[model samples]
Target: MMFSATFTSLCLAAVAVALPAEKRAAPTVTDILNYALTLEHLENAFYAEGINNFTQQSFIDAGLPGFAAGRFSEIAQHEATHVQFLTGALGEDATQACDYNFPVTDAKSFAQVSYLLENVGTSAYSGAAQYLSGGTLTAAAAILAVEARHSAWVNSAVLKANPWNGAFDTPLDLNQIYTLATSIITSCPSSNPALPVKAFPALTFGTDMTAGQATTVSFNGSDASSANGMYVGFISGMNTTIVPVQNGQVTIPDGLMGVVYAVATSSDSMTSDNVTLAGPAFLSFDFKSDALLL
Candidate 1:
């Protein structure tokens, strides 16, 4: 965990693996602030778009109880507050909002989109917790808590019976979070920001599961030649396995049939069984995913 220090030199040495070797100086608090700012900007835009494009009648048409404009608007305001706070904190180093293209085309999909954003937002804050200094850490923890609440509220409203999905929540690394973020993000002002973003894997699955066919699952990416094996877990993380990359693709001879909950690289091993004394981890925002493969 980062110690309380001046914003000028917030260190990221804790997660050096997440950073590139080209940088000489350690990652500063500005980096974390800028990244959080970018995410807030994106989320703000997402809600704003839905708010302006959809109406109360639209919500009713979608089979939802009431117009979610007020709820979503409040959430958007929270995100805006985060953006403003981060921008003010960064002073000259703040990142400008980038052009983004979210996937939701209709009001009915707002809750679905919120599920992805809020959960990812919560994970992003948790994963980055180690890099935050004491004061910034407290602020980040506050935001993380609200983001989780937003996620829970959305899930309860949308999914109904099972609002919270899993007993073991997954904490993703920087690359994973930013990769998902940039999937919908368009042009940016620079090649790299405080939080680095890489070109998407251009990942595509060969197995046609849309037809309910449970054939072998194989995936290919633009940079698959250099990539390691792919790891997959079900939404509950009850079942997970590894598929090796060969000849520019990762293939599972017998792919399981289910909705995938999480996917990561070989470096991050997620499936494990841990029934431990949960003491210090209560104070830690970053928690390991130790779901058993059942």
Candidate 2:
């Protein structure tokens, strides 16, 4: 009965809608802004925690040059500004900041979590970017650019390569974005700006490829018996479903070659994924794009 499927999809495009056309009211710009505001709050809180916990020396000790270290503080300031700006735009209707439970408890983990969050922000903004207009577009566009820069800087630190990774980037749609992100957010008191509440599995990797000879990947994060429990999400915009990774091994799409990615709770999470459900954490590595096209 699903008809009139629109394309708001990202990293994996073309989502299907089963609702009758008459029941689907188009999302207003405010709705989109509210969603974005929630994500900004998440970024702001993440950086605040990092800034509170780390010092410039922390960056130096982590092998980053002292000159580039200030970027972290700068980024924190920017995220805070974004939070303020969005809240101001929403006035009394703005979403309240909720306490977060990031995976980082140290500088090393800070770097890792920051790398993932920024990319999440990037895709979040990118996917929602098309919905804005006029003033909303102006404010968000600026933040989007900076978010990209933040990701590039961290990407370079993580990979020790050029700050820019590619000419174009893939985005995560609403469902995909929230499914991957809501896992780390421990609590959201306001709930006005709704967020995807799902317990995504924490996926881990074991070198799944060897370039030309090996184009496959493997996962070992959930119960071995949860057949079809693992799903590979790629920045190249593809969500691949793997039933039972034989001994934790399966082939990946070449389209995801040399791109950013995450291992989520499974494609099924898109609909059934609820934040309250207990499941493995989502895995988005901080190192070079995990399982890249060697």
Candidate 3:
């Protein structure tokens, strides 16, 4: 009779669990870094190819500024240096190298060449600045500035206007990079033409919390600006089923008492999440803060 009641309760609980809207998992920091590195490699290769294929004489004879050759060389070398620094930092064994994807093969047509290289380069650097750290941050800033210059030069040559559409200029920072990276991963994962970013990576954690502490796992989310849509839940197949403490949130069940637990969340479209849930029935984890991407 007791077993029958318990089985019925479990069935009801399963039905309840299936009722809410699910969240797509969030990507881990490691995932962000990997994508950033891959993009840097692609940009490096593109610049290298551009340098080899474009000569100063071609632009000068085409009635463009004589300095265009030097600018191209400078940007190419800068991109190469960035690739070297990132690869060294990530280590050869850890980093995955990728091939170049240039949109155009010919540079003889100045407007087309300018549009292809400068704007694309600017977008890549600006988009990636946030995911970088330490020396990588400095490198990204330097590259971004140069890319901006390249964009300005090209825009003036092509559209007869300032490259920045606005009269104002905005500084790109790590947070902006995070924003752009999340945006790119969400919207145009395949549009890079050079680097293909997979779904944003997810993170898992081994957490430590005081008894009764509350925590929240968060990410940029699929929408990027808000944290509303993620499907967050705790592992409940074991003896103690965690209860929902709030919307799309769960907590260490009161019955868990002094035990530690393993918790996980799987996004339908993104990376999976897993973490250690340690507690005094007071333990908690903030998924966004605690997780590191694999």
Per-prediction TM-score: 0.68, 0.69, 0.43
Task: Report the lDDT tens digits of candidate 2 across residue range 1-294.
Answer: 000011001112112211111112355676666677777888888888788878878767877655545778888899889888888888876767656667665565576567667767877788777777887888888888998888788757643543543566656556556545555555666346443322233343333332222222322324333445544433343343322233444444333332344443345344233321222222222223452432
lDDT of 2 at 1: 7
Q: What is the clash count for each candidate, in the order shown? A: 0, 12, 13
Instruction: Write candidate 3's Cα lDDT for 1-294 as tens digits.
Output: 011112211111111111111122443345445445654555566667766777777666666665677777776787677667666655633344433223343454433434334444454555455555787567667766776676676545533333442332322222222222332121223323222232222212213222244434323222212323343333221233433334423343332221122222234232122321111110111111122110
Give the Cα error of residue 271 in candidate 1, in Å: 9.8
Q: How far in Å is the alpha carbon of 80 misplaced in model 3?
A: 0.3
Q: Please give the lDDT score at residue 164 for candidate 1.
A: 46
Number of colliding residue pairs in model 3: 13
| lDDT, candidate 1, 185-216, per-residue tens | 76666534546533223233332222222322
Candidate number that wins on TM-score, 1 or 3: 1
Worst 10 residues of 1 by lDDT: 275-284
Greater-TM-score candidate between 2 and 3: 2
User: Each model's RMSD to truth, in Å?
Assistant: 11.5, 9.5, 20.2
List the candidates ranked by lDDT, beginning with the highest.
2, 1, 3
